[model samples]
Target: MNIAFRNESLPDKLFTILNGLIITVLFVSVFYPIIYIVSASFSDSQAVVSGEVWLWPVRPTLEGYSAVFNYNQVWVGFKNSVIYTVAGTAINVGMTVLAAYPLSRKDFYGKNTFMILFMFTTMFTGGLIPNYLLVKQLGMLDSVWAMIIPGALTVWNVIIARTYFQMSIPDELLEAAQLDGCNDLQFVWKIVIRLSGPILAVITLYYAAANWNQYFNAMIYLKSQDLYPLQLVLKDILVKNDIDVAMLAGDPADAAKREALKTLLKYSLIVISTVPLLLFYPFVQKYLVKGVMVGSLKG
Candidate 1:
């Protein structure tokens, strides 16, 4: 009925239909797993074990969540993870901005040398033993600083942010600001940062997600269970099957139900760990594509 469709050839119509079908199939492939996980988390443990859950929760119950919350370490791990994500993301974003701003400036000296050094680190790193010894020497072992300080800034993020600044903030704008008595620090704080929302959001999301999911660092550096992040605690449950059977079920003799409860707990923990990032992404979703695109562009 539309003018555009009216002019389309039969082959063009067929291609459009085929493309839509493929996209629909891909969407379902990605989306169905999320639905299944959520459904299984809420479903009765027996229903989950029996594979009764499909699109919706069957005989839905909160037992899995109840069991999760009842574990004191889960709460402690969650609290620690939140602290690490917030503090680490703040440091990461701040350091990235500082590094990127200087590197982005055309007049800055030795930027090429600094960029080469940065890229070199990405390709090669000090081995685990050396890294452990360094942390120990710094007195950061078994401390919260161990989690936040070691990976305070990411080099790849610095490059992305530098490119964003180069593409979006013209050199003429800097000259104009300087003429108006704006100092370098003031220009960065007021102008560059304020105008660089998309890239900032992109890097913030990246750093936040990384800090939240980090576990290997905690495993290596922290001796205290109190310092463990949510992901580490999840690793214990999912990989090692470390959950106590008595905590989930009142009757320890009920082996089948306990096994089912364990499976349900895994699903619940996954949902719990994932929900924060899922909630966080929507707030910055609008910026992600635009930021990645503009930041990728080079002179």
Candidate 2:
């Protein structure tokens, strides 16, 4: 061991200690909350309410899930949420990509002027009432389009994507494509798109998450109970405590079982609502990070 050379110029002993401390602190900060939630979700409701399930579950139960799923409305809400997420995200990504591409190019005429127009919206708005009135006048007040159409072009995403294009995509490639008789559409599809993996991932994640967790638009624009998203349904359940007592257990005769089931379903809602994002995030996380970097820096 004494034969090993020390790179003393790198600064060793104190640096190693500090690095360990920082990493430990970061890890605990992130992991503890997740652990607490998971434990609380499984614990008995009274135990959870009394704060006995702080670090780990006590009197573990699954009633919360039974309470949540037994309701036919919850399933319908889940289906509506899925539909909204899929359709809304598709619209968002398509518009964002199309809009971002041309704006990314320095040679494009009036690009700065166009960028200013977009940025201006981010700083100010026409106010909520006017926007609501416009939506109502346009006959989109009670439709899914109310959610998707209103947010189709996010200025932040557009700017990020444009930045990504400028930084991550080389100008020489565009020139070479043009020399080969490639048109704008072909260049965008064949050349620019192929190099945009990280940015695409980031955009997809943003749209998907936003669409998935959305509720306010549904609440404001939709009057139909069947069209309510999962979040809205969850809010009704939580704020109103409107769970049907009959479906709260396998049999209504047992009060203890029903109480336990209600507790489990409350926790189950948290787990269920979060599951999709958790599953989806890992698939695109690598691309997401790269996309953010690509879009942030100016050429």
Candidate 3:
């Protein structure tokens, strides 16, 4: 028998069973929605509209995906969203690393004061109108810069990265690097970055997800439809009911079929928008727990 299993008391076994049950329930709760969306996306419009879909697609069809891809603006919005996510995530990770490295240093003067100021911004902000004025003054209105610059780096991410660096990077490593004639820049570039992969991945995922899903900033600042991100385009289709009748394949005169197709389109769009993050997540997931736990648990 396993040593751990042999040592378990009756109460411990009961607790383990309860914990497993709770976890299974939670997993199903989260997982069922994803399965439903995917099944509905592939399901025939009538099946979806009639509430026939359950664990699997009742009547499988690609009609929803077909309608979604046929829309020209969907492609434009997807391209723009990719651009924003990549460029914005790069700037975010770079700024976060730069800010975090210095703050992590014990010898750095006024770090506490700087940290306090950073924390202060998190608690209170200039609010929407003032932020809009600031963005307008900076000439970012209705431009790509509006999406990328205003929210370049999150202060909370900085704190997490800072905590991670403090906990993980030993003082002796820096001293050794200095003795080897490596300057601060070289040391950070060569050693700190190499060892800080987990934290970097964690923050990169954070920034990428934020940038990808963001539509509020685009809605507020961008007036041109050409600059719209995928989320904004989806908003127009789903919430504003902006779908064009020409995109539907069946007779445009049929009101009921059109409505059903529209409902199906919603599910398709959701899966399309969500797929990239789902694909990207697995690559960084191994790093996530270690990075988050080390930073949070130790400090």
Q: TM-scores of all models?
A: 0.94, 0.86, 0.92
Error of 1 at 195 (Å): 0.9
| Candidate 2, poorest ten consecutive residues by summed lDDT | 1-10
Q: What's the C-alpha lDDT at position 158 in model 1?
A: 92
**Which candidate number has the best TM-score?**
1
* lDDT against true structure, model 3: 0.92
Pick the winner on lDDT between candidates 1 and 2.
Answer: 1
Candidate 2 deviant stretches above 4 angstroms:
1-26, 44-54, 58-61, 250-260
Tens-digit lDDT track for model 1 on 90-204?
9999999999999999888998889899888989999999999999999999999999999999988998999999888988999999999998999999999999988899999
TM-score of 3: 0.92
What tens-digit string does per-residue lDDT give for candidate 2 at 6-25? 54434665686689899999
Residue 59 lDDT in candidate 2: 86
| Cα lDDT, all candidates | 0.91, 0.81, 0.92
* lDDT value, residue 220 of candidate 2: 82
Worst window of 10 by summed lDDT in candidate 3: 290-299
Q: Which stretches of candidate 1 lie over 4 Å from their true place?
A: 1-8
Q: Name the lDDT of candidate 2.
A: 0.81
